[model samples]
Target: MRQIKIDYRRPNPVPQPAPRPAPAPNQGRPPVRGGGTEHPGKTRRCNRHPGVHMVLAGYNTEWNTVRYLCPMCHAMGLPPVEVATGVINAYFPEKGYGFIENGGPRIFFHLSDLATRFTPQLGMPVTCRVEANDKGLIGREVTPR
Candidate 1:
């Protein structure tokens, strides 16, 4: 009978570079834009939806995400701001939808903005916020009333 031993381990662990020095206080702080110079009453534009609202809730550094309080939601509280209750003038399920506010404009709603799980029905009342795009005023955050 014979016995033999074999070694398969590395002699040393890989070397690592020295840690970087901590930056000075406010050394790398980003510049503040549209602040201190702009009108005091005016709210800053939201980063996520530009030219909309700027009621900031807070920042999430871990996900590099920002939580902004919807200005419409904040101002109106329970009822969404600028929400127009209207009856569906035309709605083709899984296609396109449009509604006409009482004595107001007839805004078009896309299938993508539907927040309700149920299919839209014509002549049914709906609550939604009218948003403008390149095409014109369209409905967003749409839901059945």
Candidate 2:
């Protein structure tokens, strides 16, 4: 009978990967919109919904104030900003989408954004509230003037 060698030594420890370098402060972060720095002490509560926290939406250049939008109010189709007057720049009845020229920039709107049951015509004046989404600015609660 052949006798086998009995090894009782512990195995070597596995090598670990090198620690990743720490990222610089806000290095990869996207630039803040509205061209203003967030103030830590600024009020975060929503005006309409006192219990809810409002999101930093944008900066009002004219008013020199920060604009905040309440997520609840926005979800309910409530205007986040003051009603803006614009004219229908483009419309596609089949596509159900259009753009409005409101002096600063063209605001995109969908047919469902209309407040009344009326066909939008070219150059038609409209009042709408601007809202921010993943795709940038969009007009909501559009009302024909």
Top candidate, metric TM-score: 2
lDDT per residue as tens, model 1, 7-54: 322232221234446656755543322222122233545334576765
In model 1, the worst 10-residue window by lDDT is 31-40
lDDT agreement of model 1 with the native:
0.52
Model 2's alpha-carbon lDDT is 0.64
- Alpha-carbon lDDT, every model: 0.52, 0.64
Off by over 4 Å in 2: 1-80
lDDT tens digits, residue span 6-125, model 2:
332213212123444665775654322221223213345665798997777865654233456889999999865543556798999999989987655568899999978989999887
